[model samples]
Target: MSLVVTPLELPERWDEPGPRGDAFRAFHAHAERSNAMRFGPDVVARSPEERLASLQPSLAEACRAFVAHRDGQLVGALKVYTPLLESTDVAEIVISAEPDLPDAEVLDLVEELTTHGEQVAAGLGRGDFRGGSLAAASGAVTAATGFGGVDPDHPEVAPLVARGYVLEQVYRISMVDLAALPDLDERLAAARAGAPGYDVVAWAGETPAPHRAGMCRLKEQMAADAPGGGVLFEPEVWDDARLADFEASAASGGRTIRTVAAVEGATGELVGFTSAFVGTSTVVNQQDTVVAGAHRGHGLGALMKLANLAELREHHPNHTRVVTWNAEENRPMLAVNEATGFVTVVHDGVWKRRSVS
Candidate 1:
């Protein structure tokens, strides 16, 4: 098969009439196909407008896209993201191809896309290229955290391994049936009674100006405290401007960010927070949940999640499920999620390859 790879020239608008518009639609289609193959046919995919809006660069990262074609038809797409806030040495690459193709053809596309990814990373002065793929937990290759494994024969895994990428970590991807949640009212009451001097507050979209800095600090702390296993994730730098950029970008993509945070009653500072990103689909993505080290063990994590779920149900009644990813070793967060109604569906492997200097 003669496959041609070309950089995708992003159009100024999603509805623009041209070859770029066609490529944009094809890129989203490839992603949807890949998602269905990896997660199942029921997976909710980003709409074309949402996908285009998501490509907008933010203060944290900039993305570049590429497309692969065979016989003038798109067969694969690649996205490379370079972090601007922190972890500047790393480039995150996501590549996917048509699922109907044979393994050999799939690997060929993978190889070609990975080479393009590496070249992009080199041009950006990045030394580490990182990628992740979702797979069943029962497999021969175990994660560093000892909780999940990926079958070596999995299409996504084989290509990365063949390309010399080491499995750094595995994240448990869980789905929460909002309707089937464990007596959250009881759980919330118990969690609140167990913890004193903290009040849980919920908000949608932009963060209140007073809590913005606290939210930034909490985000930075989350980046520092989260389990990394072998993946070298640097502590992210977050400020008011960066936070605004995040909210703006999400709003542009038609995503509503619902946040539930625990505030110190005396100091009026945010101590822990949980966020849910809701799009037009029925699925809501649980983005981040973290508690400050000093405030740990007070049941703030569960309280925030319970409050967030309440907010989600009250405001976004159309959404039926919530999905989240947690490091296999993140027992605290995992426990909170499991107790709330989340069950593991699959495990995602984080693979990294460092350039040889």
Candidate 2:
């Protein structure tokens, strides 16, 4: 049977009251499930209603969806977001009828989207389509189109390499598993015994305000620690107001953001930190985990992680899994994961394609 792909009608179909709503909801549910299995539970814990509502505006304005139909049955779909951003060309989310579909079909779908993306960019007078997190199967399209690999340590890129995509840069995805929470008292006692004169604290919502400045400094430090000289894509700086906004976003999505910080007793300087959030639907996602350069050898990373894990176990006991990612080459962060018992699950790759005109 022949396959046909076409653009999805927006607001009209998306906001409608009946069959369209059912289809849209089903599609989003499918997308969420795929994301959970492919990217892990932390990344996607939204209900179909929540996802559709959150994505409606973007999908209505700058987003496009392509549906692949084989024998009149919808087999695959891809959603691309084209916000007028500085660095990324397109942000994408995908779902497929055949989760284990052959690599060739996945490549074909990606190529088709790339072609569509190029035309969209040209129409807007932009000359490139910069995308990230190309799955293993889709890496073929990315490679074929000259999308340079970036961040080899990126959690998604290894599978792409196995399928022949080139390695570019290494970025780490740091994670902790709630299922394996260690004894907090023993972990903290060990860290304090080893480091001496260091204290750790957990904060959220308004409580994070006191440490906003310290967190912002850590945010700036991230660029230096990032492999490939990581770029801060968002405009908002890490400050009290921004932290509040993040907390709000998490709360609205039914998630809790827990930020843990390690501070020196004498100097009161922030040395290490980690953030974890539990979704309303019972998934825990780790955000950023960092330790200042001066305090590296003291095992503060593991301490901060253990503190966060303890808080999650006590406060959000319903959470089933704790999910996070790190660049493949980030040994230090990976060391913390090893100490905390986070097993490697999924590997993904980042791909880029520039316009040839």
lDDT of each: 0.84, 0.59
lDDT of 1 by residue, 229-292 (tens): 8786788888888899988997786788888999999999899888888886688888878999
- TM-scores, all candidates, are 0.95, 0.74
lDDT of 2 by residue, 1-357 (tens): 756766655444445677667567556656766666665664556765455544543211355666676676565676666544333443433334346656666555555545565565666665434444533322333333232234433333433333343334333343455655546668767866887779988876444555678876786566456443222233424565555554565554345577888998898888778877655556677877878887887878888877777777778787756777676556777777877878766544444444555
Q: What is the lDDT of candidate 2?
A: 0.59
What stretches of model 1 exceed 4 Å from their correct place? 41-44
Error of 1 at 259 (Å): 0.6
